[model samples]
Target: MSSMSAPSLNFLAGGGEMGEIIRATDWSGSPLGTPETWPGSLRTLVQVMLMSGQPMFIAWGPERIMLYNDGYAPMCANRHPWALGKPFAEVWADIIDAVGPIMDAAYAGIPTYMDDIEFLMTRHGKQVETHFSFGYTPVHDHEDRVAGMFCTALEITSEVAEAKARKADAERLREMFEQAPSAIAVLRGRDYVFEVANSAYQRLVAKSDFLGRPAADVIPDLLEQGFSDLLDRVYETGEPFIGAGVPITVTDTETGTTIDYMMDFVYQPMRDADGEIDAIFVEVADATERHKAEKMQAILNEELAHRIKNQMAVVQAIVSQTLRNAADVRSARQLINGRLVALSSAHDLLVRGKGERASVRKLIETAMEPYGRGDGRQINLTGTEIEVGPKAALSLALILHELATNAVKYGALSVPEGHLDIAWGTSVDEESTTFDLTWTESGGPSVDEPSAPGFGTRLLRGGITGVESRVELDYSPGGFTFVLSTPLADIVIS
Candidate 1:
């Protein structure tokens, strides 16, 4: 057991720092024994592994003793100088669970190759994600026995991480495009192939088969509407184009009906790294409803101006008639004030309504507010829901005010036990619908018919003539009653 004398290690010479460490290390008590008595195959493999510029390693014999080249030193991390003479399994104890099976496969001569394999390895006291592109080749010894596994490895962690980051970025961008509220689309090349169209863009076009299809093929209407020309200008000049409230019409594929749209949009040319425009990005907001509202506001402003003039005329007529018919100056002033208040109440009712028509219930309630004590005994009125046109509404309010004033001066409302009851109903026939409102008063002094056609008498008859309505008055010994009948269509303005 004296064995062969120590020998010159030419196979381990001039191999940089790793080779010196392996050469100087005492392997006398290990499973590998001294290097002088190493197998010829293991010696030759070690020599080849040492001379490599790439990272390479050899685990030899049944113990799988570790030996690696200078190129593999950085991969060893803090374990380099100490990892020189240990078994492969002990040296890579951190990743042995993952690399253990691959080693067995290579040692069994099946061989293993991988472009990328992942391992969470603790290196330099921190766990890091590691990737390797490596190959394991079976090393043979004397008499054709498998001696060990040789490995050539390179780390590719950064490359994998970068690729994953780019993929995640693309997915995030795709989600943003899909969920955008406004219409968004991307067109590529001169023929304008649709590469991306979001849900809003699909609805705006009234179509969904847009991906990879030419814009003209899908929507020739847009081409005829000169959108293609705009796109051409943008693409050719490499400049952005903006359209505000641009009218567009699209035909529905299912119904064959044309839908009109007003859109505020942009055709932004997308340029490449060479500064050449390759595609155009389209973003659009539908402004049809907004445009319609603006137009409606303009019309309302005009109507408001016209109504203001008409209201002044009506007020002037009321003032002139009140001053002419009053018996005294003080009486004329009171009459004018009362008539004006009634007119104001009518205007308030219409304003709370549609401004063109007023509700019958609101008109009566407002007219009677000054006289009613809120006890439900003075004024009892019940009626079907009806809308009166603005012109008729003003006259009706004044008529109600006059009737109440006359009652307070001479009729039922002059006494504590007096009460007024008015009821209205709709009578629908084949020809037309007529509105009938009946007013009756009781529990007061008797009333006599007027001797002449006074201002109040003329007002009651002619004030609501605009609606083709007729008013009737009855003077009975018990109480006075009044009734009004008019065509529903005449009083209700659409």
Candidate 2:
């Protein structure tokens, strides 16, 4: 080995990768010369950066050549060893736009401290978002003039990511709460001050301002209903309370009128980490409509029971009278079966109407369906649009059914070429409106008047109780004709 002076080891006294690198570095080609010949201020700053546990750096001279401790290498990523001797602008060109102003201020002798400053930097050959908290202070030379800037920085990327994640979670929870179908609210503290009220809750209260107000203040009537006391008990015991179909009368803030409502609701205590009750969560559902439906259902059930009993008695009377008048067992069975079937068909029409008014045309079609063949060429129906209430619909259905059955057995429908024409019209007057309907049979065997009234005959002649109707039957050489006159007020929907 040729004689060459050993490189100085004095810089290694600072003790780290950065200090070791400085000791072995060649500064002969640089403007600042060797590390041994550098000013005391620059050396002192390098020593401080090397010995400290924090990430620190120094940009020196007019060129702002960069120097950094080992702690800063990870932040530099792939630029580490190469960044050691490079100028500050070249080393951090990716974030120069954001860092340039801070550098300028430091150079102007103004110390700056920034927290969670965001920047985009290229690390490991890929651009990434990063956040940092740092302080930059001016470094002095031997003449007590600004020569460089010293900085201590902490990469807060993980902390900021966690904070952003928490914020996103909170926003999602708020959105779900607002859009929930049931009314919901949050009350904080023993006083039950409202913290959050969703849109459903707002609508339930007619959009009153309830936030930050105690429940009693918002709806004083609830206190009288013991709702406030229920919340207190739930909170005190850390238990939940649930109620259904509970009646509460509240005054509408907008209308200034008291309204009665039924509610299904719960008051649930929310506990903190230490298992202490902190607040109450309220969930409510409006049950007023359901309550009304249940009540109406009970009343309807009672009425239906009474109606069924009366119907059974009427059927019993019909069977007994029909059997007594029939000539033999076969005739009696036939008459009973026919009448029962007619009643069943009428009952079906009433059921289809849901106990409301039924279309007159629909009733006729349904009642005569069994007697008519495909396409119904044997019968013709002509009438204006008319609706009849349940009682009239059932009675008319029964009358039509009996007429259709008799036609099939002994009248026009008994022959292939025979035809029945059904027509109805309305006559309106000052005192009342009357409906007139005629059933005419033609192209059948010559007819003869019945010697005695049968069950069907009586049923057609206003025999159905509660039905105010008059009927006339004609037996002529051509065929049979039936005429019906009924008050429109008893059947018309209006």
Count of backbone clashes, every candidate in sequence: 0, 0
What's model 1's TM-score? 0.67
Instruction: Please give, for residues 126-228, the per-residue lDDT of candidate 2 as tens digits.
Output: 8899999999999888788899999999999999999999999988898889899888999999888999999999877765677999877886777778887
Taken over the whole model, the C-alpha lDDT of each candidate is 0.82, 0.80
Per-model RMSD to reference? 10.9, 10.5
Candidate 1: regions farther than 4 A off? 1-20, 33-53, 69-82, 123-128, 142-145, 307-361, 364-425, 430-494
What's the residue-level lDDT of 455 in candidate 2?
57
TM-score of each: 0.67, 0.71
**Clashing pairs in model 2, backbone N/Cα/C closer than 3 A:** none
Per-residue lDDT of 1-494 in model 1, one digit per residue for the tens? 22223354677766788877787778899788888778888888888888888999888889888888888888888988788768989998999999999999988988999999999988989999988899999987766778888999988888999989999999999889899988999999998899999999999999997799998888899889999899999999988999999999999888999999999999999988998899999999999999999998996686566556545655665566566667999988887787678667755765554357777777787766544333577778888888888777766766776676577667886666888887888898899998888879999898999999665676677647467877789999899998888888887763
Q: Which candidate has the highest TM-score of all?
A: 2
